[model samples]
Target: MTDWKKIRAEFPALENWIFLNTATFGQLPKRATEAVACHFARRDRYACSDFMGWFEDADSVRATIARLIHAAADDIAFIPNACTGLSLMMGGMDWKPGDRIVTLEDEFPNHYYYPGYLAAQGVEFIETPFERFYDAINQRTRLVALSMVNYSTGFRPPLEEISGFLRERGVMLYLDGTQGLGALQLDISAIRPAMLSVDGYKWLLAPTGGGFIYVDSELRRHLRPNIIGWRSHRDWRNHENLHHGTPEFGTEAEKYEGGMLSFGPIYGMAASVEMMLEIGPEVIDERVMQLAGSVRDILRRAGGVLRADSDSLYISPVVTARFEEKDAGVLAHELKSRKVLVAARHGNLRVSPHFYNDETDLERFEAALKQVL
Candidate 1:
């Protein structure tokens, strides 16, 4: 059984304010903060001598992340952020002149504009309405990029269905999982996209500037690493070849990790992910969905129009709502003044709840909305 009240105590930020902004940046637990401090302390004491130990810790973090998403650690590569991973894949890899990429109209800028950048190079960019996203694919479509959950609306597309459709067409599916990875249960085996990237700060409860990318084993063999560094090679430690212009690349996802990782955030990521794992994804998903459902219900009762679709299968922890007459920005500001934090995106108020939030938080949010809106 989960001691949710005790779990909530681990996040000190919850004491002063009602945080509903996990969609923007998650509140780090004490464990994550302590882990970062410990990392810095060790680095301050031992300096470069702790470098190998950092690698060892990173490897463990990779394994933990892989376990979270039901993926193999060998397939995971640490990247700075989701955009960098996608950029590396799109820009670094070879693409034919006539290759087409399909994307959703409501996708985040990274998914929208990165493919558009390829348009100047003769690649065809096809953006269809969110409902028609899957139908936009054809024989010429080389890749279909989308977010697992729409950042603006919190609309979750049926990844398994879309991936299956793409698989039949031999087209690659690229997914940005920053919005849904930690708060929801993601079984990669059920929806095996060719490539997937996640920003750890938003949902994984880690510090900013830390995330990962996963390239399917078969796809990794075909991708050529454009961003290469000393660490990209199998014989990375060979001091004699360090200054040489020519070097052999590793045959795995590590080849794409250009250089030394951002260790501070990674240490936090490892600790936070370990806490999440100890709590269990299934438990987290259940609690998040329940809290989000309550939030939606209370907002509706408080005269807020539900903007996000509460699809039975794909509903996540993010709940977006709009007031009939009030502006989203004004409402967000009012909530902030009352210490009920939320995000205003595309004229909708987005409330993302994590496991730390409780009924009292929801009550405060509803009361604030009633008073302000």
Candidate 2:
């Protein structure tokens, strides 16, 4: 049996406030923080001397990430952020004048700007409503980018259904999995996308600048890393023979890895992912949904609108609620003043519960909500 109460205590922020902002940035537990601190301490003593050891640690993180999503470690590459990952996919592509890319208008800006920048190259960028995405795909469409779970409304799209539709037409699927990876249960085999990227700071509870990109085995043959660095080679010690003609890069996604990575963030990410694996995603999902369900019920009774259907399979760890007469911003401030934490997105308050949160946190949020409403 999992001792959830003990797990909740691991996050120091929960002692002071009701933390419902994992959608924005997840509060790091003590284990993650200590791992980062230890890395820094070790770095001070052994800088270049222990370089290979740190690289090994980063590789371990890649392996842990692969296990979390059921992908091969070779397919996963450590990226600086989700935008860099998205840019890699966009840059690797050979665009034509009439080629189209479909994406949602409400998606986070990272999904928009890179592909949006390609508009000057005569690539037709189609920004459509989430519901109309399927209809937007045509023969001209070559790539479709989407957020696995929308950052604003906590809306988890039907990736499996959309991928099925795209498969028949040979359109590629790219997903920003930042908001959904750690909080929700994900099986990449079932919801296969050509590429999936994550900025681990938000839901994965890792330090900033730690992220990974996963390229499907089929897609790997067609795409190459747009930028290459010294570490891109299989043998990093080859200083004499730099290049003869075309330099040989690693066959896997490791070819995209740039210069030295920040050891603190990489080790921190490894520790956090290992912790999540120990707890089990199924246990975390159950706890999160249980808390979110209670919040939805209480808010509904008090005359609030649920942004997501309670019975929907797409209902993720996030719950967005709009009070009838209360402004979302005002309510958010009121809740904060009452020592409860939430974020205002669109016209609703986004309540995102991580596995560490408990019923007491929900009760505090409810009491604060009643006062504000």
Candidate 3:
């Protein structure tokens, strides 16, 4: 049994604001902040004395991330952000002339930008409505890329069914898991996407610049490294022997990492990942869903318009409610003035609660909504 009170103590920011914006960015725990501080302190003490130790910490962070996603440690690579991962996957692919890439409408810019970058190489970009993504896959389609949860509407798609359908047709599937990483429970092995990327700052409670890319072992062989660096090689210490030509590419997905990795963010991320491991994702998922469900029930009783279907089980932990007469932007600002933080996206208020939030936070938000509406 996970104690909400104990979990709340880990995050000091919760004491200040009723944070319902985990979908935008999570509040970092005190321990994670302290870890980064300690790392910087060590750097000041002896600048280059512990150079090897820093790399070891980075490797440990990679292993922890791998465990969280149920992927082999070698199959995960740390990237600066979700966009970097998307670029690596999209640019590395061998797209033939007229090869089609399918994505959803209102998709994140990177989804279009990366594919658009490939368009310069003669690849075709196809944008389809969310309801028709399944039917959009055809023989010319080489890859199907989309978000697991829509950031605007918080709609969680049927990943299992979509992946299965694509796999049968020999099409590659890629997912941007930013909106549903810590808030939802997922088994990467079950969905088996060709590649998946997540930004830890949003839902994983880590600092910015922390994110990873997961490349399926089978798919790794087909991907060429777009951005290469010394660290991407197996033996980065042998930099003096660069005359021997680019070090043999790593057999695993680590080959995708480019240049020097940031140690400060890795230190902070390690702390956050440790806390998640201690509490367990299953418990976190249950608590977050319960809190979100409670908010949904209250909104329904208030007769607000819900963008997502009521029967949808895969709804993102984030919930958005539309107002009939009142402006959502005005209501969002009103909620913020009352110390409740919610985001206004696509004319709806996006309320995302983490495990640390309890019934009190929910009631406070509801009360604020009533006053504003």
Candidate 4:
């Protein structure tokens, strides 16, 4: 068994505050911050003297992300964030006028933003509840975009069932793993989605402005490289001399990275992911669910909470509770003032505890929540 108390010590930010808000942002591990600071420290001592080292770090991190998701390193593209990664894939697809896009009702805005633009080009954008999401997929449906775990209600969709169904129908499945990636186990072999994007900040315990996308080889014909630059080409080597001309971009997912990368964040992300791999993904998942489940029970026993409604079938680490008499934003502020941080989303209170959180954090939250209620 893993010593979760030692794991919890990795996050110094947890020392002073009760942080159960991994859904909005995760507390960066001390090693990640140190790695980032070390990179800049080297820069301070010497200019771009170690340019090759940056490329090496980026490539190694790519391989690390591949191991995390069970994909080929070449198939992974480092992205600025999940939204940018999704936009890159969406831009590449050969969308026709009548092509239809189906997504969930309350997804992070990326789902609606990209499809909203496609709507002007005569593409049908259908937003429905998870219950009717399957029925919405007709012959005209080109893609099914959704979150692996819902951000608002903490509902996890049946990816195995949905992926197999879409595979039989030859439809594409675009998944956003921001809320699920590091907390849950996601094997590409099981889902086989056409494309998946994730943010490294939340759950992954990395800094902002870093993420990745996994593009399937089967979608090569449909989704061409819509964005490119010097680093995007297959022969983008430019250590001694710059090579430029009519560049040839490969069908690998890296073709969408239009420019240079932020190496500091790259190193930070590598450190964070390495920490997670050491702890074991399954171990982390089990711990997170255990804490969130305990949180739900506490909320239940406390009383004074209303049922906006909940689906207990497929649940993730995100635990949400509704209080009809209390405003969620006010409650969140009150909790934060008491040094207990949580999030209010779409009129519901969303609390997400990670592997670093301990039972003490839960007890404090339980006390704070009761006092606020």
Best by lDDT: 1
Q: Kindly list the per-residue Cα lDDT of model 2 for residues 315-371, writing each as its tens digit.
A: 777788787678999988988888888899888888888888888788777787878
Question: lDDT for every model?
Answer: 0.86, 0.83, 0.85, 0.84
Error (Å) of candidate 4 at residue 113 is: 1.2
**Per-model TM against the reference:** 0.96, 0.95, 0.96, 0.96
Worst 10 residues of 3 by lDDT: 237-246
Q: Model 4, 230-305: lDDT tens per residue? A: 7766777664565667667766677778678888878888898998899888888888889888888777776635
Number of the top-ranking candidate, with TM-score as the measure: 1
The weakest ten consecutive residues by lDDT in model 4 span: 304-313
Q: Count the backbone clashes (under 3 Å) in each candidate.
A: 0, 0, 0, 0
The RMSD (Cα, Å) of candidate 1 is: 1.6
Evaluated at residue 338, the lDDT of candidate 4 is: 100
Q: What is the lDDT of residue 60 in candidate 2?
A: 80
lDDT per residue, candidate 1, 109-192, as tens digits? 898778888888899998887667767777889988888888888888888888898898899889999998889999998999
lDDT comparing candidate 3 with the true structure? 0.85
